[model samples]
Target: MSFKTILAVVTDQAHMSDTLAQAVTMADALDAHLSVVCIGVDRTQTGYYYAGMNAAVLQETMNHAREQAAELATAAKKQMEMSGLRWGVSEAVCQLADMSRYVAAHARFADLAILPRPYGDDRGIELEAATEGALFEGQSPVIVLPEGGAELKMPQKIAVGWNESAEALRAVRSALPFLIAAQSVHIVVIDPPKHGPNRSDPGGQLSQYLARHGVKVEIDVLSKTMPRVSDVMRRHVSDMNADLVVMGAYGHSRFREAILGGATRNMLETSEVPVFMAH
Candidate 1:
């Protein structure tokens, strides 16, 4: 019911400091153990470009990646040493193809995973892979920080983006700890179906469920003013001044979301507030 363990995945050095600060702050706030995984991605794979290249090129690339990963791990450990929280740091030097697997191995052990938003211009391929690994392979809820990293506050006002899908149900369950602790929780449903269980009352069933868990919630049944569902959800979160948003990731398949563009993909790319997601 509570987060006792948290995993933070970091790759590039540019985001290391901010990402670690965010992770440490959350861990301190929740009294949870922090696990830092620093990955130095080796994109130099054996392919057509390297078909005629020397073996030394591959060896050198790998050694450089390991060195970088070790340095990042050392820096992270040094920072966390004075954090006064139970923490550990590990480094991985892996090829791009193997990044997700490595991330999943560590993410599976934690109650929740913290990640930097992997959609901006500065984002790396490894970060995107790590996110997919945590959500799909690790089967853990993830809190993705904004581009510049937000002031890691304990979520006082939380917003839930609801639809009648199993993914949404699972997301609500995963975010129970935060919802229980928040001062106010809002369940926002945009153009809910008129024939489902909640036909007469869109968010009534969910409100009752949360009430049993000692969470008072308000329901907002909104008509989508913008073209995309994500647009309406984003505006609602901003207007409510919610510090955090909880929603299911990729109600459709990942491939479909990537190609056809769904709400989950849009939110990931543009939400200013931290997004808590699970799939």
Candidate 2:
């Protein structure tokens, strides 16, 4: 029902600032074990296996990278020792050029995963490798931290961006542990469908569902005239003074009449609050 084991990813030294610190704080609060995985260079990515490359040069390059990664991992382990929480540190390398899957595999057993949210212009390969692995591949809920990092506040008022999609449903399900304990939960739906029970009342089904789970639920709907789902959700969260936003992470597709990536990406980039996502 609560997070017992948390996986905090460290892409490099920067991860210490952007992710590991937050993970350590949360782990301390939850009395959980924090596992830090430091990623090493992928031989395939550096073109180290190619024929033209000098064998000595490749050896030197790999050795230097290994040394740097090892030192960073060591530093992280030292810090974790002072975190006052059960903790462990390990290292991994990208295999088959699929860092995302590799990263997700590392976090598969964790109760929760925390990773950085890269801005639109900053969508580098490393970002996807670090995030998508857990968000898409792992079963755990992922908390995407804001750029430059933000404190994982004691969530009092939580906001849910509702869109009747599989992804949204998964997000809601993954967030049940948090929702059940929240002081207030707002299911904000932008232009809910006008059909069946929705025509008579939107958010009725979901409200009833959460109510059964002992959550104090509120359904806030915005008109279709609203500019965008992400924009309106932000305004509503600000109005509600919510500390966290819960929503589906990349489950919608073009076939679903919604681009799953669009709204999710927007929230990831623009929200000052942490976004909890599940696919």
Candidate 3:
């Protein structure tokens, strides 16, 4: 019912600071152990690698990455030790293709996984692969942070992106702890699925369900004028000053390559706040 062991991915230099801030806060709040996984690897072994960089250049590039990883690991270790919370780090130097599997193998046992949003950019395919692998290859829910940054709080305001799919149901279940603790919970229905909220039967009894669990629930039906409703959801969350967005990740994947749904894809690309996702 509580997050007791939180696993955070700490690659992606752009996302490093944000990861530590949120991970440490979550760990401190829950009296949990924060395990940091910094995936540093030689992509040359896998035939394809970082865009435009050859093996010789990549070796130098990864040397810089490794140095930064070491600095981060040292800082995390010291901070956790001072905070009186248990922590560990894994700087797994391995093949690029195996990175996702490496992360999932370790992440499956944790209560929650924290990750950076996977970008299909020239240099970020591995991060996306790891995130995708975690979503489908593990049971735990993942909280993905946008590149800008985020801090974990007591989650005073929370928004649930509503849909009727099994993934949505799983996401609601996954977010129980946060919902049970929030000051206000919004069931945001945008372009609902077939069995979702409607004019007369708004929220399809989910509001009642959450209310039964002592959650302060409200249902809102938002009309979407854009193709990507995820953008709308993020806007709503920001408008509500919600700290967390709970939703299902709807997507198709092959060879660790994911073709996400519009809402899911947009959220990954442009979330201003932390997002809890399950699939």
Compared to the true structure, candidate 3 yields what TM-score? 0.84
Model 2 residue 233 lDDT?
83
lDDT of 1 by residue, 60-86 (tens): 888999998999999999999989999
Model 1 / residue 278 / CA error / Å: 0.9
Ten-residue region with minimum lDDT total, candidate 3: 251-260
Q: Write the per-residue lDDT of candidate 2 for residues 161-200, one digit (tens) a residue.
A: 8877788888888888789888999988888776755766
RMSD of 1: 1.2
Please give the lDDT score at residue 36 for candidate 3. 87
Q: What is the lDDT of residue 98 in candidate 1?
A: 83
Query: Model 2 misses residue 225 by how many Å?
Result: 4.6
Would you estimate the TM-scores of all the predictions?
Answer: 0.97, 0.88, 0.84
Residue 90 lDDT in candidate 3 = 71
Where does model 1 exceed 4 Å of error?
46-49
Clashing pairs in 3: none
Q: Which residue pairs come into collision in candidate 1?
A: none
Q: Rate residue 256 of model 2 by lDDT.
A: 45
Q: Find the candidate with the highest TM-score and give its number.
A: 1
Pick by lDDT: 1 or 2, better one: 1
Over the stretch 1-279, how does candidate 3's per-residue lDDT look in tens digits? 888899987665566766777788888887888888877654555555667777689678678667756766766566556656688877756466777788888779898888877764524667776776677776778988766655676577899998666878789888888899899999998875555245467686888888898999998888886666777888888888888889988644442324435677778777878889898
